[model samples]
Target: MEGKSWIFKNRPAIVASGVVGGPFEQKSPYSGEFDLVKDTLWMEEESFEKANRQLIESAIQVTLDKKTLSSNDIDALLMGDLINQITPTSMAARTLSAPYLGLFSACATSMEGLALSAALIDGGYCQKVLTGASSHNAAVEKQFRYPTEYGGQKPPTAQWTVTGAGVALIEKASPHNAPLALIEKATIGKVVDNGIKDPFNMGAAMAPAAADVIERHLNQTNQTIDDFDLIITGDLSRIGHPITEDLLKQKGIAFKSGQFLDCGKMFYPELPDVQAGASGPACSAMLVYSHFLNELQKGSVRKILSVATGALLSPLTFQQGESIPCIAHAVELSSPAVNSQSFRGEE
Candidate 1:
């Protein structure tokens, strides 16, 4: 039953989350937010690929350790990464030897995993699910653009691919303990292409897609911008963030600036050389799990509409002059105390 969204009747609980960041992220103002910060992006691995595996696997371990449960206790592991064929995520899964599902929606993989994780539990497929995403800046640069060894000059519109990984454990909501937040609903996004061929200008390319999903979610749920405490957008960076607001305004759905924020812009906004800001699956995943979840725990926020956006483009596609198609997935997390009307009142 898809309304404006998929409302999980079981209300999957975010039992625990773990985040890890690279050296640049550790020095940023948001440094202290994550569970672990590596001094080197390489993490003592022979290659960036191996390092990415370490980052993601370590994050899952951190969350599992918090629950005193190993991979053996997990019903399934849903993971994704930016690499081609999602190699790092696959390697991490192999180490754990848990049932695995590989996913990719560019940078939107984090929320995609979370949304599916909720569905798995809500559908009685499992009692618990582990979901998350990872990305390595050096590795992505090699795949989509000039390698780090090239020292290529980047334009202001280019976003820095974040070197990080974030993981989360979600289970059925229970009375034994208050969850970090409840997964109430998710709005799947459609592919939106506006003939944008420049990979550097992803922010502009992705804004329309984010606006579309947000609008559909609000209209479908019979709710307004007034409902969520925060409307979080994934990886729209500085340039795309305002475009999203403008597009929404054109749709006659205006959102307050204070209430709307983007994970890409928030992650490393003021940092020099970060270009447009951070973009990667880990950008929104880390900011949401490591930072915003803490705020939810402290009673600073009761609910959030997290929309993770992704620009669907490959090196070959760009070379072939195809426009970048984009997508956005929104996940609504509400505190049990102020569950409010953000959820479906009748089912």
Candidate 2:
């Protein structure tokens, strides 16, 4: 059977209740302005399970406040995170009263959840879906990169894992609710391995996968880079972003210099000094919640295509001589001009 379309032509109604959590008071390798490298609010636990629980609880609180929703009111909770067996997300869901669905797309998990929830609402599956993703700096480091205490010097292209979470409530399109943005079109990525095997060099490993999706998205939608105000790449970092662009140019596609931005670059630009860029699930989530969502609300930018990229590889698999498998999911965001009228009346 053909895959279902994740993009919405009529534009779905979604509100990012806002994000909660940061690398505060956590025992981590980073310090200073970029000290919050843990990318999460929970640092009280040494075990991944405990940290995951804390992260989920924080996300749930944010969702409740933003939507004015109680745990019993939500139809379903769709969540994911980067961890073995997705333990963090699973544990967090156990505390919630809403039915839960777990997903795994590495870094792209947030976008994937948003896309699927939008599709479900669009198909009349239900209304009021909550989707979120989180990442812990310590756990990710221990699993993928070196130990948090290793203190090894990173390459220029390496991206710091953000310790953060983002939650968005997706509802049926309506005339009243804020029309945050819709998934206009999406080009799902196939697993691509170019034989680059360094776990630390994720940018290089995932660049080809990013290039493939960019090519296919433009081709399938018949939209060029200029069609949208911005073409944002999730967590590819500085190094992978350029590599993806260079490869795209070779394929006869070109994006304006300022037109392209990386979520990794937007976070921790002053600290961590990531030569290449930022990586991790929180990298993209924080960028979307903190930067893009704010811009859409303020009418700074009307249309945007945010693509979250992921390197779908485990340390065990990489150690077993497996090449990196990467994927990306694209979501479009637009301003809610129609809903703003309601706010005007209240003012």
Candidate 3:
């Protein structure tokens, strides 16, 4: 059977899940699990280094429980984050028992991790793989813009960096496992730098990159806009979302507004007081791990193509008057069958 056929046949299941350290959980209006804020974990300080370590440990514990395997069972660990040279990920991986491979795609790091882990399992390079991403609001703010206490009012196109992390365990196919929807295809983004220089205007910087990847993904997969149940963009906020739709439509691909969603928008509707939308690796990661993952498990939605978008610009580059280079990574997820067995177990 062909690679795609094998993917569609032996669906991979996300047997376990975990999230560590975030400031969102402690903040106002987001304090309860039933409440959107409660559903997310958050950290208080600007310590991404600390948050990254917690995230990896939490994910490893969850994976161990779900797969009935230990850290030694994992053949490899793949991770990424929005920190410098992905320092948070690399440093966190040092403590893990599994071998590690660092990756980066800005906000798209988590989906990138998933895609790579799926490939490793499908290619028989590994049996069990762990993948995840983390980001802290304080660290990102200080690194990309001003400090959290800078007290600057942001423009409508600006986004709030989320202080959180999410991790998932991808394992080999087994008769006792539920079909954890496999990654049918991935559309790795090419760097799209159109010379948009404003650091505050990330929507303008990233819109084209999102459009480019979406187009390329559809073209490569031979799938139309209607092929998947949902087409989710990472952090395109209100500004970039419309532009992405326009660009895709210009390419003759039409996706319904209901079918199209943004993780930024989902993160906090009440925080509309927030400008461009929610951002940072954790913004999208939390939404996917908590909201979308649950929907998939309950069979509310079947197939989804999630694209995590990022603006590859730093405070230094922007200060140096360089344009923002943008990229996105796309991952596909599907619902497991009703008769499948759950992988939930004690750690």
Candidate 4:
């Protein structure tokens, strides 16, 4: 494939999606777009990790319900989260009883699943695959930083982990079913460590990796900045978003501010105490599956390049004074209307 980028010949279609969020996410500007919103993180579970698993299960249920399908209809389930060893996702898989593959890419887990789902469908390996990612604020905070109960203070660079889950039901394109969007291409990023060790400032550490993938995706796919209606990043927030823009310009690819946006910065514009906006596997998944897909369905936007970034460092690695290694995966999507036509980058 051209330097970690692959063009999906079959153009796997995203048929349906479901997003669930907690009380913290209810305040998000796009909260109404979510299929379900729980008033508390617990969701009647005894622990936050259990609650995280509940979120994933709920999201999967919502996705299946939207398409009027059951877990038995799903050929495979791919998902992950930020918890240790991604136990929450595995437990959810256990409940679903579907052939499952648990993934781990820190916050970038969502697009990683989506990319592989498209590849599998394009290659004729599977028919229908359920892929997604989830995260819990309290669960992740307790593992990465201090528990919310401890009232630990954070710097302005620290981002608030989102409490949410998002899943998508993807399958081979069919004349019988209309698609929400078509997965056109995918670019897998290389690991990039900027020598930053602070767990709080994840945006800075992930910015370079995001830029690297975006540049590679554009160049390898023979596209330009103008090819996409939007190029959105997973988190990166207020601090890292600008850093990514600057880095892209240095690489001979520049775009206007409106052309590029970050899910973290847009998720909680009016909310308070989110110093650097949202950061979690759910951040990008929730946004793309809900808002951006809805926009495509409404014909407001036709094409998008979504880059979900991840910090590969675990608590042990950071605690041991290791710099964070970051990565990003880019997935190009086109509206169903555009999918009917012969479309490619600038001739």
Candidate 5:
């Protein structure tokens, strides 16, 4: 990996994906994008944590079912969540029982998992890998701050963590099975700390990191923003979206974020309670696995970059008065029919 970026020659194919969303997600514009939607946030589980595990597990099961494959067919499973020690994800992964690798990147875990999965397949280490991310609003709120029952007043900048799970099975290109999207390249980001200690204002803390990775990805690929049909950032919410746009312009990469989609903003624009927009690991996972991949299949989009951002802060760290360190990972996704020449266009 040259300076946290790798260009894949083996271009693995995302064969199938599954998404599960909570009741609030059902209210979102793209609710129909999910394969399974729960009528309630609890998902009929006793505790919110158990329900979170159910979300991730449901996604894995559905994805496997769609492909008519089982854990035996999957070489490995990589997944992550925002909960402490990724407890929910670990609990869910046990059911898969494949050679599992659990990841922790706060929210950027989805792209982190995707980048690694592509590398594994491209490097000839595995034929197929299933990877994804999950996050629950209640679980996150209770762990990171106050419980939802506490009824704490969140600031306008605070974002609602998405309650959902999304998983995808990626494998080498085959003659019979057409892939949803092709993994072109990836740029891994470094930790960025802007000294913003407020955990509620995650957007401000993560905006710089998102811009940094976008710049690095474009530079490494020798391309510009316009080269891709869309540049998406995960869970930036309302506050961080414009700030990231402004940061990119300041770096001399002139563009408008309106041309791109922020998962947080698009998830539930009609829900007034989502002050900024949706967030957490599940936000980007759900959007990509459903909306963008569906569009790519329909030929509505040719090429897109999925950049999932994360705030690397723990409840203890925040309470101890440490600044929020953040990261972002970008993965290039494109329709198999799209000409790769566009990726070679610029300096």
Candidate 6:
């Protein structure tokens, strides 16, 4: 790894992915891409948190079923969620037979898991890894803010938590399995805080971190925005999307028209009551693993840079009057059709 970035020479491949969403997500324009859609958020479970865990389990099971593999075939499991201590993800991992590693980066946990999965395979330490992130609307809201029954008024900056889970099976590159996308590079982010204390304004809190990592990733890799067919941010939503664009512009970095977008903003463009749009760990995960992966497979986009951002503020921290610290993790992905000439690193 060189300066917070890892250029994978072997190019780990995301062979298969699974996305499970709640009934609310059924209205999303990309709902057709989901592997499974539960008719209710309860998911036949007793509590919302249990339902949250079920989402992760269902997503992982779907991914395994797609490849006709089982837990015995998985080398490791890296998963996370937005619940306190990420209990939902840990509880779900308990049911899995493979070695498990729980991760947390607020909304950015998805890319964090993917980056580590690619690193493990690229370093020849593991053959196959299950990595994912999940978020539940009710469970996260109850923990992070007021309960759904509170009837509290929210500002337009507030983003709705996505009720979904996205899991992927990443493995060593191979000739037999034509993977969806290849992981070429990953740029880990540094924490950035601008003294933003309102949890409802997560987009504003995370925007700077996203821009910082993007600039660093391009500089360290000697690449430009033109190198990628698309550059997508995790859950910046409508508010942070423009802020990020302006920040990049001030830094003298410009993107081609239609070259940049935010998964949060696009996740539920038409859904009502989604004030700023979607914001959660699953926001980016669901979009990338489902719609964007299909785009790569269909050759619609040859290369993509995904930057997943996170606002690292707990309820306790907020209650104690601490500012929200934010981070963003970037992963470079390309269609398998792209040749080795596009990959960088010491081979």
Candidate 1 Cα errors over 4 Å, as ranges:
1-4, 337-347
The digit string of per-residue lDDT tens for model 5 on 218-336 reads: 98889899888899999898899889988999999877545677998899998889888889999999999999999886768998999999999998898888999999999999886
Clashing pairs in 4: none
* Model 3 TM-score relative to the real fold: 0.86
Candidate 4, poorest ten consecutive residues by summed lDDT: 338-347
Evaluated at residue 286, the lDDT of candidate 4 is: 95
Q: Per the 3 Å backbone cut-off, how many clashing residue pairs does candidate 5 have?
A: 0
lDDT of 3 by residue, 130-179 (tens): 88777777677767777778787877778887766677777655555554
Instruction: Give the local distance difference test score of model 3.
Output: 0.71
Candidate 1, run of 10 with poorest lDDT: 338-347
The list of candidate 5 runs beyond 4 A from truth reads 1-4, 339-347
TM-score of 2: 0.87
> Model 2, 123-157: lDDT tens per residue?
67767888878887767877777777898788676
- As for model 4, its CA RMSD to the true structure in angstroms is 2.7
After TM-score superposition, the amount by which residue 175's alpha carbon in candidate 4 deviates from its true location, in angstroms, is: 2.2
Clashing pairs in 1: none
- Residue 334 local lDDT, model 5: 85
Clashing pairs in model 5, backbone N/Cα/C closer than 3 A: none
lDDT of 6 by residue, 134-202 (tens): 999999888888889997889999999999999999987776667889998999999999899999899
Per-model lDDT = 0.88, 0.72, 0.71, 0.91, 0.89, 0.91
Query: How many clashes (backbone N, Cα, C below 3 Å) per candidate?
Result: 0, 8, 11, 0, 0, 0
Structural similarity to truth (TM-score) of each candidate = 0.96, 0.87, 0.86, 0.97, 0.96, 0.97
RMSD versus native structure for model 5: 3.2
